[model samples]
Target: MKRLHLICLLLAVCCQEITAQYRVAVIGSSTAGGTGAWPLDSAWVRRFNYHYKHQLGIVDSTYTLAVGGYPVYKGMPGSYVPPPDRDGPDHNNNVTKANAVLASLPVPANAIVFVNYPSNKYEQYSIAEIMFCLQTIYDSVLKAGHRCYIITTQPRTGGPFDDPAVKRKLAVIKDSTIQRFGVANTINFYDGLYNPADSSILAKYNSGDGIHYNNAGHRELFERVLAKNVFATPLPVKLTKFIGNYSNASIALQWTAECTDPNTSFTLQRSTDGRNFENITVLKAKGLRSSLYEFTDRQPSPGKNFYRLRISETASLVMSNVILVKNPQEGLQVKGLYPNPVNQPDLEAELLSAQTYSGIVTVLNTAGMSFYRKETNFEKGLNKLIVPVQFLPHGQFILCIRYGDGNSILRTFSK
Candidate 1:
């Protein structure tokens, strides 16, 4: 009977090793700090904690080293120095402190760090500088034997973001992020939340301000991370023949893998750009041998689409090679012009573009007198432009958009 009890105890220890849970640490600005999220629990980080503890049966061991309004520079290592007119690192919320805290944890080896400083440094610094700061943080995490995931920039409006040149820079930063960090180590925080017509937060997700996401937006972000299955147990698995194609307004992804463990799972992830990826679906292991699998993305983004697979077993995790598919571009069109009666301080013009280019927007009266005019760049897909109408008299006016490609559009409204 003593031998039987000893055998049971050893078996329990083995099982625990096979299904070990990891600790999560977050370092970021307002969004990760839970601003704009009502009751705070609805914030993405809190929601992730709840899911980790309640659904995954893991201990509530998540820690957030984030503070509101912090930029990437502010979260840098304590040794980092700032450029002229910029503030130095805040040691309290800096990455070095975060690393120190993680090192003191019971299981530092089983830890993952998320770096999310969306759009804070973009306005004051160059893309190269921003990437350098991010690289420093990423290296620190890696040097400590921990995995790191960087969240891409989310959409914002007003202030500097309203300027066409600044908006163009934001696009470059988003693409540069994926180039610096591989797709497997980045998350698409901007994907479904931005209004394609104009790069602002979608109305349903906006928390009354041009920046920050509301509860619905936070929920969407949490779901994105949940779909990532980052907490899954890592396993050694071989995946091959990964490919995808677009047809009939859908993208079909197919792949085969050598599955050894019955506890193995496969997660399909998709991305609009080749950089940040989000989870699409999760599949359980079918057999103990090589098996074929396929999934169709019915609502693929227009133009290039990227797909990859994350296979997880009881003791290992692997990511498949990325594949791309191309879809026809949606042509340019005016989606909407709101506040026609001009009761608000700003009139919004929503547009869908087939490609990216600069355009001139003019607000004119019935007698062809120009009231306001500005030139802005438009990205492919949906975009929203804010036109200030407060200074204009309460009269009929025309909104004319002249494209750089020698094309033009016109809409009429009254204040």
Candidate 2:
């Protein structure tokens, strides 16, 4: 009873530690002001606030300080500029407005300012000018010991930015700035909202004018931001690949990782349904610059086997994409290989055997050159095996498996 009470107390403390409270200030233009988004609450900023409070379990207060025709920089006289101070009344310069907003925050140190540059208007600001204004705001925020997240401009249908060349230039600036700040510090709203086919606003999410977003657009924007900011777990290890193959009545999980730190490790997870996963094993890190990791589940489910990898770090765990492996159907042939085109050094193949047999596996190019040959012992049921084809050139190839019983089969694959 005493131990149980202590465990509960520890769990409570951990939960409290993970739940961080924040004050997010959305500073931008009409889009940030919930313009064109029906019912107001469906706006991206509001949806993000809701998600923060519910999905992330974070107690965050959001405030929008956006106005129509608001540009990040102080444009030239003819350009769209904010009202200037008329001697008695202070001219609301972009920087001044931001400063006022930041000053009003009760806890600036714990605040994260979301600054969206409203450049998709009648006149587009030069990248240099925009960066200068952004740098100014960022410096001010840092001086106040607060963090700032900048949102790049979204696509527009008919604005000056609609020109492909102009849009590309603006994107270059946004991309460079985000790279400077690191992926975690900026919200990539452009990537979230831009239509790849024509570089216009996605039809379903647009409010017809291309400058504003509909409710669904706003929700999608919120979801994308959440994927990078709240839901994502950043890790030091770069995961190159996480895949699986089925054979020998089990599933083999393979992964390639570039471990920057020697202490990095991984936990392999298995799921039958792909939705619910269970940690199958913890593999020790190779602790090298580049390493290959593999784990085999000797008893996978009969049908589809889903696998993922979780890199264990000092502070958090980073998960990989799920890969599926399935037992081959009853046959005397190779079932399948994951990532068929093959990006890694090896490919895993699932083979079904009618009886216990010995076989020779060979991989040949279209030119008939046998680049790889290996002998394997197959069990009566399902057998999983690895065929090294990293040395083969990138193109089409054929895998031939010759059994001692004189039965041979060939399957085509691409490198």
Candidate 3:
């Protein structure tokens, strides 16, 4: 692969060699390359590389391979430009040059790979094309036992890429990729751009032309992006318990202050079955440094309910943690199991019910083996049912009951 641009990957001192210790190669064009007067360590990659290991429990080395004059998908879709000096692939190709470098770079299989797709400036490559290029890169570095991560490019400076006509191209590409792959391997990096019309952030970040991130912009890119890759390392986050309850037609949404994307904010959501959720509202965070964020949903429907806080950033990425609000209409709360250690025929469930509903009671052992189950209707009052002991021999179990739209109530018991 050859390119019209000559992009040298910026490197930093290798941190403690991880399992395979291969360098996590960040591949992209000039925006990703980080621009400055030359030889100053102010680029985003360097900023991320400079101070992150100490913050995270572990660390990995970084190598940036972003060039200045290339479009997101390389050559625009219809028109092709030959390499400026034969340094990379012709200007029209999407990732030919980057792929060649990864295949030839001196890195181990276990290293981390972050490929920032070229900005869709020229409409050269389709989302499908980018996905193909990504898979190729993944296979190339997997031998070193490394993992790959991708940042759906940020909102661009100003160009055909940022036009309203194609504004959604980046987002569509990201969502399709995420649905096909999953959070474990393929991640959705965009946090969803708030105001599509403004490209100031993009302008600040881009290099020579206002297309890519300059050194300062690179710093924002990595911190806003690469560092948060779920595969990189779990960010040690402190989330406050959402302290509130559900009342009548109003379901109160509440959450303690939480960390947010430097470039984005949060939108609260509520779910009855966790599987299906609706966005409540979008809350702007107080800059990036302040922690302890909170938000409340003013409206909640009737029934056994749930509330969750979602974090959105960039243009397409959104993540929700595991915090649930248990306000079920025909709700059942398994407060405490009478005798924890026991040799009894059936366990007891003390349920406080507000409404009557039909539900299935299932008892599972520690290994998730369902030992006992039954479908019974509960009256709008307190009900105590004994679980048949003959179901299992001797052991501890996590008992759960599901009813009304699959909302589950949980409690633990030992025998």
Candidate 4:
């Protein structure tokens, strides 16, 4: 049997060697510090340490740098006061504290840092402001060449001094942005605790005060983190082929993998526009051996169809490369714009249509905000449209074509 040389295809895949020791760091405030949870060992952080060891077989060294009552953002004048202990060398500056905490570790590389901070008290800071602080700390850790994870603010009870509206708003703000940083890099504590209907922390999980967790609460958090299995050392699964092709008004995807884990499954997902995706189906592994898998979409949407797979095992989620299938048989199809690195304000897009249609062209920034929008008509067959972008400032932008037939194509270009 020919063994698939899968390692070469993976980009810097990290495998645990016999001599390698992986470190896990927990950086947050009292919430992550195990505050209100008796005998700190029962704190979620400590529970995570146990799971990392037995579940992942990692020589995990766990460290916590949580200052009780610390705010993730710097204190604003006349709004909130810094914790008394903030005067220490770390200064309670989230970025400074994170850097110091990480630097103090004996082994920094190959380390995963989980940052959790409660936003209950910081009513003055908007979600965007808090996100900026979290991003700063995240960047600092990344600059040091380590993987960093951020936790969304958990549900809390509004207190007399604490404004209920602000706490809820901040929690939501944190939840939305942290996940966007990286889907795999975030530990979603908010979802595990917040009541979906009321947007409050579930009563059972909430410590009577509504800000912290009880034993059961901590345990629930521990379970969610364990479910992610991010700490698990990856087992190499080589993929020799991953291809998507259009045929007979359908799109078919096929891939071959060599893996020894029997408890593996592949979730095939499809997307019309590249950004949002929907699961098509799931394929389970035949056994702890090599296998070939295939899926066909009988009725794919017109225009560009994107396909990707999420591979799951006992402890990891691996993403496959995205493949595109272009079908210009029924709906409007827009091809790439020329001279993408445009030096001038004039840009052109190539459009292909099977029927007459009209649609809008929108240009968005990195923030997903539309700065330029215009409606245009497409004739049956091929058509070229010239767009004027000279009014836009210098930066990157996404061009999207939304047709009347509920078909759209998106492409990113710079000017």
Candidate 5:
């Protein structure tokens, strides 16, 4: 049986490698799991997948399971009571509501299950309850035969934050469990991104509204968490403008370029109210080459529009500025994504030129999902994978894929 299991694992991996595809997921609570790839397109998960394709040369079939108002294991401990007006009738219960949302999805192949273990609720419950919830989620994922990643929940409770208490509490749960189990998969969300003193990266990531990010906040989140490839590099790009498409359901954009990298293309993102944005789509360019280029955001909606082009490091340590999508909902730019976006799977690129290459992709969210999977030879170019969108509720996302030579590319799209 062990041999058979090993063989199955090998086969599963082989199929993905050959196709260069993936079906990944993001799971957790509100800020960490909020809908729309805030820093990216609709959610960080989707953005992670896109970055995978652009930089690491992988495709993505991504899903997100983060929801806005649900806490983890409410009866346990530190869980806070959302304002009665905000939480509505059944806001008190925690995982019960989240589980209902998760239960509806088609679990993906080689699923990446991210759970916010021992959240603020752990503060209220005894260590035992916190441990029980942790074990339950772990065992459940193991039983389902999926790979589980345990990231210490982000700093939830920075004072005057949405719930500084909640953030601090979750941090405690993360540290305690890591010490007890000595689990290698455990992550460091605080040092990696949050303000150590405040314990509320969410507040920093959020706008003065105390809920979402301003342009500055969004950019910070992108810089800290966005994964970069160690091998691949993007060609030089100069985006000239970003404007809303009032006539069409899209945004209008243009750019100029020169380069030495293997692939050349532009990934566009849009936002409502200017603070949060979604990876609308990607515009492909014939690779191992360059020239001036122009594109449009045909997916314009009836609202304020924010636009940006993820400028790849055509050389090194080089990035670009954000352009506005003046009129959203204009053209055929992919818009209004579902619970899980980034429909493309991982891809493996074959540069006609002898350029360094990489294929590492990571999916993340505000719910504290971090790290990417290192995959080689995922599939030939353009292979597709059907992934579950059960990571979090509908929201913003990004796909950050790093190459083999210390270069990364980002693509934002919506879920």
Candidate 6:
């Protein structure tokens, strides 16, 4: 009888280990950073973490990489440099950095990521720009092999946020965020907190500063996140490795999966802009406990190629981590422009060079009129050229770079 009891106990332990909770990472601004909530413990993120660990009967870990008064720009990738007027990325709070940190842990692959930036950039950035930033962050999170939940913009009172036009724009942003990420993947932070009359934070939920929420409001936010039931679905497969190598005019991709179901299917997808992906090929799982897959792309995009795998099981679908393979040639090449749809005074161009060469960078108008020109030298490997566009009129312009070897590149940007 004791031996049978011991066997049952071991089985119970194994089941507990298999059913471990999800690891969560939150990248957000002041609200998520616990700014408005008095005593901090009442903050939504903290409350969520507490409920997950205590009420849920499991020790799910939650990591918050939020900073006070930070906008979407500050939470961008570390390599991303904001336009001249904006602040650069904060590595500690950046979404890319947070993803990396979470990935290094020995946790389940289906980590939960929360992106909450509420009304931080309403005055400084246009709705389009704000959407772009949010989309970039969301894509990055998805590419990192995690589930992302974007929190909608909450209402803010006083200052410029009270303007009817600004409120309308904020509403547009909130709706756009939901429409873009889908309702299932978004946490509604604006529903009960905002007053319908003026679109400002309700008095009961306001933290008295008019910008953030109090303990009651934070509780409401926590409730919204809980209502999503993001943790209900169980991950069907585990992707152990997803990597790529570039060589001999072709790129080779390989990935390994563990504990995959026999009905699983893998769809190899490629992207040039990292936002829109096109399917390359699809393969069925080998119906093994562990499996390895490989593919090669003979004709990769000239510059950077982004690759990811969509693993579809009978009940669950997930994406592998995005791998970037640069296909560089022997001459001067213009990679791309940063902060596209330029709003700041200065625009930066990323260039890759095989050998040291002198280059002339020029900004030309639509009618071929030279608006700005600069003569600069590019060293071998990657180079960045900053083109001043403050003087250029508000319109679309072309950037042309003429190398000493007679190789020229042309790219377009907007002011």
Candidate 6 backbone collisions, by pair: none
Model 3 lDDT per residue over 223-245, tens place? 45542553344432335555555
Q: How many backbone clashes does candidate 3 have?
A: 48
TM-score of each: 0.60, 0.48, 0.45, 0.49, 0.39, 0.52
What tens-digit string does per-residue lDDT give for candidate 4 at 1-415? 1234566434334433443366766666787889767777788888877656655657446767777777765422222344474322244535455455556444676677777876644565556657766777777778767778778777665663245566557566755765668667776676536653445677887777777888888986776576566655565666778898889988888999887777888889887655445688999887656678888889787777888877877765566778888876658666658778887768888887765566888999899988888977788788997878888888999988888547778888898
Model 6 C-alpha lDDT per residue in residues 11-128, reported as the tens digit of each score: 9889867664578889988999998898989999998888777656444678899988888889888888778987778888888777876785455355878999888867779888
What stretches of model 6 exceed 4 Å from their correct place?
Answer: 1-19, 105-108, 233-415
Whole-model lDDT, model 4: 0.70
Q: What would the TM-score be for candidate 4 when compared with the true structure?
A: 0.49
Q: lDDT, candidate 1, residue 19?
A: 62
Per-residue lDDT of 131 in model 6: 81
Minimum summed lDDT over a 10-residue window in model 2 is located at: 82-91
Candidate number with the higher lDDT (1 or 5): 1
In candidate 1, what residue range of length 10 has the lowest lDDT sum? 227-236
Using lDDT as the yardstick, the better of models 3 and 5 is: 3
Off by over 4 Å in 5: 1-18, 35-42, 53-59, 74-109, 117-123, 158-168, 180-183, 196-198, 202-204, 209-415
Q: Give residue 369's error in model 2 in angstroms.
A: 35
TM-score, predicted candidate 3 vs. hidden true structure: 0.45
Q: Per TM-score, what order, best first?
A: 1, 6, 4, 2, 3, 5
> Please, what is the whole-model Cα lDDT of each candidate in the order they appear?
0.81, 0.68, 0.54, 0.70, 0.46, 0.80
Give the best candidate by lDDT.
1
Greater-lDDT candidate between 1 and 6: 1
Residue 49 of candidate 5: its Cα lDDT?
56
Better of 1 and 5 by TM-score: 1
